[model samples]
Target: MTILAIGAAGIAAVLLAVWLKGVRAEYAVYLVMAAEILFMLSAAGRLEVILDAMERMRGYIRVDSAYLGTLLKMIGITYVAEFASGICRDAGYGALGNQIQILGKLSVLGVSMPVFLALFETLERFMK
Candidate 1:
């Protein structure tokens, strides 16, 4: 769909949710699900742009593939965790959302640890 169509659809969904809130409010859950589906569909279309940019930049940078891969993994994990947490919050599970955020932070640290250790190891060798 074009940007205008997507925006119109989102606005209509939000209005429907608002109306549903005053009636059978629980049914509004479907609105949230639909919105997320639309967002994910649009994101799927843009994924190639991100990968293409990454690939184009690879020729100009001398960074190790391991570090680049780890960076991408961390970014992907962060986005996924945030999206999941938002859904949890929408479902009234604030505690679960918080837990998801904490796990995401830990996961990002875990992913970057190897690169950190490698950097320090290289520094140690250089100093000796």
Candidate 2:
């Protein structure tokens, strides 16, 4: 979906949620979650294109496939964590949201450990 369309939909959802908050507060949270799911679904289509572009770049750069795969996993973890955390915060669980974010950071760090090790190895070789 185009940015304009997405923006319009987001604004509409927010307005509706604000109105629903007055009538049925719980339903407003549900509505917001539904809107977030729809938005994520729409963005999923574009994610394929991004992945394809990254693959082509990897081929041109001759980088190890494992590194590229790790990068993708890190990116995925970051986005998913942010999405989940946002939902939690919206549902009035700010602490849960913060924890989700921290977990995401740790996950990303864990996933990138191999890359960090490889870099250190390369640097050590140069120093030798």
Candidate 3:
């Protein structure tokens, strides 16, 4: 599993970082960041595979593509927000991390607005 591989690598790197702390702390930090980035890339690769499979199903289904696209956008915002916040936190920028989370919330709300509008419009038409 990718998570297992990452966990093993993380353990080893943590040990190495501990050993390097007294000699070269900056290099240790860089090593840790590199590992984090590698894991992130692996996750993204897996997510892409899933998304591609879903895209393939589009031809067989009569789905609302716009809603699907918006849902995907919301998913992206969630992940990107988490990623940005993690980076900020790791870099010792607490305020920046908070801001990133706020931005993510706003992004989700923005992406969902069209769905909300459609729902309300449908209700209005039914009432009439």
Candidate 4:
């Protein structure tokens, strides 16, 4: 999993460099999405491991469940945004892709409100 992730990052970095060197933005986006897909697929079969790692990190970081939940929500938001944006781009509506991205961000923020409120309530109780 780590290896796949590292390779994906390396490829993305190279693709980004290619774009910076004037290699066409469209190709760069394709390459980035391909890399993301590859890494995501590699991680797909290891969800248990991923969750365990997240839990271990939570323990090490001394973070509450709210923080972990928010992190997960952000991750989900990123995945959905990328998917919708890609679809819109494939359909030849770059403008729609941008709109989808904005909508995704808003939806994630809205969904996270409950968790944030719960966290705030916990903190308030602690303060009292």
Candidate 2 lDDT over residue span 1-128, tens digit each: 89999899999999999999999999999999998999889987788888999889987898998988999999899989999999999999999999999999999999999999999999999999
Instruction: List residue ranges in candidate 4 displaced over 4 A.
Output: 1-49, 58-70, 126-128
- Residues 1-128, candidate 4: write the lDDT tens digits: 58866777866666584765485767765665676566567656676776898899987887878767777777778776877787567546899999989988898888788888988999999999
lDDT of 2: 0.94
Rank the models by lDDT, top first.
Answer: 2, 1, 3, 4
User: Whose TM-score is higher: candidate 2's or candidate 4's?
Assistant: 2
> lDDT per model, in order?
0.85, 0.94, 0.84, 0.75
What's the true lDDT of residue 28 in model 3?
74
What TM-score would every model get versus the actual structure?
0.83, 0.97, 0.78, 0.52
Task: State the number of backbone clashes in model 2.
Answer: 0
Better candidate number, 2 or 3, judged by lDDT: 2
lDDT of 3 by residue, 22-64 (tens): 8998777777777778777877888878688668778789667
Quality of model 4 by C-alpha lDDT: 0.75
> Candidates 1 and 2: which is better by lDDT?
2
Lowest lDDT 10-mer window, candidate 2? 41-50
RMSD in angstroms between candidate 2 and the native structure over all alpha carbons: 0.8
lDDT of 3: 0.84
In candidate 3, list every pair of residues with a backbone clash. Answer: none
Kindly provide the TM-score of model 2 when superposed on the true structure, using C-alpha atoms: 0.97
